[model samples]
Target: MLTPGDGGAGPAVPVGTRGPTVQTLATGEVFAALDASPRGLASADAAARRDRFGPNELPPAGRRGLWQDLVGQFTDLFAVVLLVASAITFLAYGLQKPQDVGTLQLAVAILGVVVLNAAIGFAQEYSAERTAESLQAMVPHTCRVLRDGERRELPARELVPGDVVVLEAGDAVPADCRLVEAHEVSVNNAALTGESDAVGRTGDPVAAGPVLQARNCVFMGTDVVAGAAKAVVFATGAATEFGGIFRLAAAAPRQKTPLQRQVASMARRVAGTALAIGAALFAVRVPAGQSFVETFVFALGVMVALVPEGLPATLSVSLAIGVRRMARRHALVKQLLAVEALGSTTVVCTDKTGTLTQAEMTVVQVWAGGAPHAVSGVGYAPEGDVANPQPVRGLLRAAALCCNARLVPPSDRQGWRVLGDTTEGALLVAAAKAGLDRVTEEAAAPRVAEYPFDSVRKLMSTVHGDTADGYHAYVKGAPQELLARSTSIDWGGERRPLTEELRAAVTAANDELASQGLRVLAAAWRPVSDSRPVQDEVESELTLLGLVGMLDPPRPEVSDAVAACRRARIRIIMVTGDHPLTAEAVARRVGIVSRPAPTVVTGARLDALDDKDLDTLLAAPGELLLCRVSPEHKMRVVTALQRRGEVVAVTGDGANDAPALKHADIGVAMGASGTDVAREAAVIVLLDDSFASIAAAVKLGRSVYQNIRKFLVYVFSSNIG
Candidate 1:
């Protein structure tokens, strides 16, 4: 059970127990159930539990031996037919009165072709699975834990149930655990859930749901991007959510490509025609005074000759050339068969962030002192400006001071990176644009304490010491929440009462920014009694400062790419974890949604749909946007599209995307930001993580299909002649 600190990690409390029910209980109750204390489990108890439960690591999946994989490469129909022809040729040479050297040479050449193709094919496939080899690297190796009333660092795999684990910013969560104490903890679940946004976690009891959605819980492989927490380990190893999903992704069978199906059809037809002609020769020759044995042998020779011995080799070479071409265009084709399958793609199910839009967050507008101000710049470079940086100076300063993200300057090998949450990073960048360096600001009024943001409060505040007016507390959060906490407004450089009209004005400004596809957050501050005021006391009597809106802008080249897809008669559908409004806004900006009203389905609504309902929804769409989707929902969408005979090409970036990537006809993954699990399942990896590369790949694939047809035409013509 996911009992906070209740129940041992031993056989008494196995993984996969009803986590939500256990997590919904109070921390003290869970502690009683686990026989654990706030200080942590006694070392003796932990060691005893460890003896019953296995190590806190996922079980390794069985893999095909290298020799087995190599053997499989030679077992296809084309290779088998060529092998049979080579054997027959050798047999015929032996039966000849005098063995012909040219016949022996012909047999060797055919065998060589089969061996060479097998070697090349095996090598290519082996290289593609490199990501799988490093799957264990996803989890952190060491973590800090409390035992016997003392804190210590230990290998994460050694952690047992009932252990109180300490988590801080930048650490990967070692196991599934319920938080006992959370301080402004926000986790980046994108590695497991594909939700690009970092969500706040809390220690308070919440409604029962999926363990991953449990407000007080964190799962394995996710990153603690901000704040800190103390949680009790409940599930580990194969019992964890990450491990369960990993197995699902591994178990998903690979779909046969279009080329494979066509080759099989060609093989069947060729075999039938060869048999018909052979029987016809045998029937006529035996009756025309020829020896039965001689006629039979001659007919067999003709049949063997009918086999297209060079087809497999030629196709492999052509596809290899196409792979090289796609690589040069920033699309790495891992599966050779997917080259032709990409050409047959009828629908493109793509991601929103990093795929169609720039993943970097940029502050576009700032509302301060009752005036809207514009900030220029696009990324984390800290090279933009806020016009007349006087009125919004307080807003910018609060945004910078109340944030945890750090900006790394451009280095020799890499460009600037936000290094933390994108939203916080954008705030820091906005402050930098106004010549208010975070390093300098922190020095003037160093931060003393902070009340970290929690799911319930929806607000975060930090207290800074040495302020001219005693101590100052800066707060930033949802506009409505911050405004409700305020008693006054900083309007036109004058402190004014936050009247009903002023509140409406702020709300109207927030709506205007939301309508523009920007994520808006309001800022407020108030002088405090001391450096460490209670959250309840400091948050009241506050001056509502202003609002800041940031956006993850659409990529500059995406419009043309979307146009190209439309011209090619391929459907583009957006599947993301964003809100419906945000999803529709971005969808419209990128030309995916052209009509004024498009079909936007949320994950909750999708969960209620059956197969027929889902089909109707997909079929009734002008432009489809599937928002707030979990990994399972994304996979279902791809499965539904495929059931309708639509050749699906899906793009993914997270570990949860692995199954969907594996199931699609053409699985395109982002190499730059994608998880190892996703890259392992994908057939194609976009090296540059750009949607334009996918379009280029589709064009390249069509060219490869044309090449295949040309070769078929040439071969058929020669055979007829």
Candidate 2:
């Protein structure tokens, strides 16, 4: 846990115009003047640190010393029996005798191995402190802040409450603050909240605090996804960042995973039984007038026979092997315990945005007039042939010209890549599928004008010059917005009258596409007056294009991954924040839910359920998806699942996911796209971030668990003999 001493408030440096300034976050109260003051803010920072840390705040309890730590780590029954036997052998029959030399050397070897095991285990467990340090490294060492109307670079640690900080794209927030002003700013609070897309920021004071979006609030440790703004620092360091949870989390002793706890319990029982047998032997033989030496040797032999000294070593080796195997399969194991933990996982909570679906979105559905056109393929690959190729050149031209993102050829033509948002990329791919060769055709007919896509409008417009005729504008976005503006529809068969009835039919088609787990995008276009630029006069869409459908499409190997979990008796629960329909659709595709009446638990309903209902609901098969669940709800679900003797592994990559990630027996996070905070908290990180990777990880985990079990069995049998 961090105190003010560790990268907290230090001496403040003077900031020139556009420099750091201190003011209250909500009230705009000036805690310290902005003009020409260096020590002034420093004094305030010192005071804040004192108030936060305080003299009354106690330090964590000191840990055992190296020797004591080793001994304490091996507090298992097996170790205790060995220690007792060694003491008896030394006291009774001296180690100097020839016969005793063999026994003594063996005893010495056992002690050496035991101490080595303890040392290694303790070292590995304590290495997580370095992970914390690594996390702290993610924070920018220095930040440019506005003080006395001048911008100056100062250590980010010096930032105190109420300091106004300038933000730009890619800058990790220096401290937590409420936005005083913003212009087209959006923060990716995915680190703090699990929301996938960037949240739009505004200067307006949040009217409803209940719905806590990072829109108006700039939080520490969160990066600006796009745009720029100024915000007053309300919190800093541990207090400002994720509500000082890091400190609490770091200080909290790393609890043994449920499997570890169970193994430890079993090990202790085995050790106890061995000791009891040795004690009984000593008691029975000693009273028969046998010498202390004879009785001691007899007991010592019995103890050695029962104690499984190599069990810990064998378990460690198995885990190491499992980790290596997983790494070979592209799933890096951060914590060794995670390998075993995956074997015992009962529920796997995964994120929807990037984990289950490709992070890159594409236009899957095109709503043109009264017709629905399904776009083929998932992601940026342009190899897949369109299911229904449209022969009309104008419709293809509209889709190509109307989109913002363009497909670029990689080094190889077969390896096509996109240079835009997943949604826009999807459109480009769809345009390509429509037989509009964007790379060659767009070059020939060049884009004359274009308007970038924005959230508020939710549509992108582009005009192409020299496209057979004069100019055409293709528009793709929300169906409701496009339908409201459209004047007519082209029903491939004929130019049909687009009435309210027809519009509802189009809407239903889009809904049907969505119900099947395809993200549907409505595409429309108009032949506008080429005299004016495309942006100025692009609002009136004359034709409604066909609807396009998209799905992340399941990983090819996920089916087998799910089947493997089933074979191991692990129940797979997909917990996500996606719509129930969408999540259910994906689950069904992955073979998680085959039945039609699959039970789905929503976040709101979960909150209302008592423990009893929650427990009963978990056992119900066919219900694999929990949709729109809050972080707290996830924690509850994980805990409840665990209470029912099911091992839970939660996979997530957002700040809201932190609590459940910490609560679960093992937490897995996406390595590539996951936020640093999420990775820091998770036990395992999926480097490839594929469900297939997780499946492979689970297999490795199971192998590790089996090896541990095998060692236990071997040790027990050898001892009994």
Candidate 3:
């Protein structure tokens, strides 16, 4: 049923129909098949093609109308039981005692409770659904493409097959396309493949592989990270690789929350018990010389009393209050039963970014002139100070000059914002903390020429100087790369010749920082006599300035929340798309894994395990950390945990997280950073994207379920009295 290109705005393509394999075909052949060229489709032809292929977008999800939602409110088991009880009471009273107004009043009151509860539930659900739909509109809606040989911006929905789309760093790929040209292109396929690392793309055709892995192809929903590319759209809308995932997620059957299942079971047992009691009373009283009408009336009263008529209303009020309490703590509950599900959560499979950490990179330490200086503050805000700024001034200057990212001053209510990569932004912030102004520094020693960072070199260099300094090249990149190229190091305001011992010491320092889960970047500089020296020549025999240790620091409140989870008998497992070292470091910092040598599983290792192996792993786990895992791996882990009788809660914020979010007992999505698809699939959205909020929600959820049980006990006990 999920056949690609089957249903859309244009003519339907029959399932199983074959066409030219786009990836295997030459660029010219692909262009011919699409009726397009390098010049791109003319306006008239583009319009016709648009009409034929339809808008390139996922079909809007069908929503339940107000009327349907109202009807749904009365479809619960308790509501149905109340309706039947009212009808039976009315019939028995009318047939046996037409003059009795009390029986009629009782029937009328029971029906009123049903109507009132249904109306209240309907209003709450209707409002919540509307809010969720409005949030979905916030996703990116436009992209750049070529039309009639001129580049123009257009709504992503209007893109069709044959369109020549342009992609740049930070741009989300709008549709599936084959690369016609690429310039050091690298894409973050986290949304599609769940790999946090950026993948390099090429225009050259691959001989054989899965289409998603082809070097010349780019799929929808992924973002370009480090380069530019011109790709010809070959698959649009639901026909793309992303669409297959969309269909898979859409088709996945929604399971009943644990609360719903338990509630239903309790309702069935209570109903059966009430029926048998009523029947026994009728049989015994009628045979003991009581009038038939009197016995029937007595039995009716007993059934009504046992039914817990106020339960529906009480449950609604309790859940509503729980929702409000969670909202105050920055967790928005989308479904009432999800609150109860959260209470029962035994394992929380949380992502590292935005959940455990701040998700904003910050420079915490700088090693320069043979001493370590700590940098204060945690985000883009330039309010922190560096310890001993004077000694590290050149190091900070080099960090600022070698970076391409810019920091925009706080505008309106917003604080400092980064215009480039977060890691680079951290460097700029560090420079600011060290009393270096990038604008002033650049003006004094303006850039001449530069070498941009590439996947192969893993380094970036910027030449900035006058004729006096002879064009000093400031370079920053992976510590290993920079250290290998450096022949000397700055020590105590003096340049020393790089010796074997010094090199080993630098390597040891880098390893120490890395072991602590910090991302280390080495800064070095060299004099380039040529105003425009070649990158390879300009990067050699440089003086190493020092190393900068940065980290997306763990949220200050998460450690307390993790401790609370432990106290509540809940196990927190970190499943992330980040590297093993980074994930392990964050996990240890957040207290998710206390042991120094916790089990860390990767996607590759997960793939190698069978279901039995996975089940065994889940069973034996003291504390589990899954790193560099894809969405499928997350879902599998959730499923395996469920099979072991543990209630699971999954937190995520990407398109790849949608399926697992839907599959979990309670899916918690990040309201601030989550994709539209992820938000739609989740049961709860953390407005602040904090682990602390999730812990608070669990506490409130437990209270909600406890209150419901207390109300049930009070109602049943009152009926007995």
Measured by TM-score, the strongest candidate is 3
Which order, best to worst by TM-score? Answer: 3, 1, 2
Model 2: residue 3 alpha-carbon error in angstroms:
18
Q: Against the true structure, candidate 1 has what lDDT?
A: 0.82
Per-residue C-alpha lDDT of model 3 across residues 1-721, encoded as one tens digit per residue: 1123535543333232113355666777667766678877788877766776667887765557778888888888878988888887787677665457887888888898899888777766666667777777756679988998999999998887778999887688998888888876777676676554467888875665567768888988887765678988877777777766666667655657787787688789888988899999999998899999878878877887677778888878788888878878888777777888999899998887766787678999988876789999998888889999888889989989887667878866456867556677899999999889999999888998888787689898988877556678999999999999999999878999989988988888888888888989999998887778888878899999999999988889999999999999998888888888888888888888888688889999999999999999888858888887776788889888888888899998777777788888999988876777777778898878888998899999898888888888888889778
TM-score of each candidate structure, all chains considered together: 0.89, 0.77, 0.93
Can you give the lDDT of residue 412 in candidate 1? Answer: 71
Residue ranges of candidate 1 with Cα displaced over 4 Å: 1-17, 35-52, 97-100, 131-140, 147-149, 291-294, 357-360, 369-371, 376-391, 408-421, 448-457, 465-471, 484-505, 526-542, 555-557
Q: Which regions of candidate 3 are displaced past 4 Å?
A: 1-35, 96-98, 197-199, 410-415
Superior candidate under TM-score, 1 versus 3: 3
Residue range 419-507, candidate 2, lDDT tens digits: 43445566667777677777777787677776755678876677667656787677767777777778777776366667889888888
- lDDT (0-100) at residue 413 of candidate 3? 42
lDDT of 1 by residue, 590-619 (tens): 899989788888999999999999988887
Full-model lDDT, candidate 2: 0.64
Better of 1 and 2 by TM-score: 1
Q: In model 2, which runs have C-alpha deviations exceeding 4 angstroms?
A: 1-99, 115-177, 180-189, 197-199, 218-233, 240-253, 365-377, 380-422, 432-474, 490-505, 527-538, 551-556, 622-624
lDDT of model 2 at position 379: 69
Question: Can you list the residue pairs that collide in candidate 1?
Answer: 6-33, 6-34, 7-33, 7-34
What is the RMSD, in Å, between candidate 2 and the native fold over all Cα?
6.6
**Model 1, total clashes:** 4
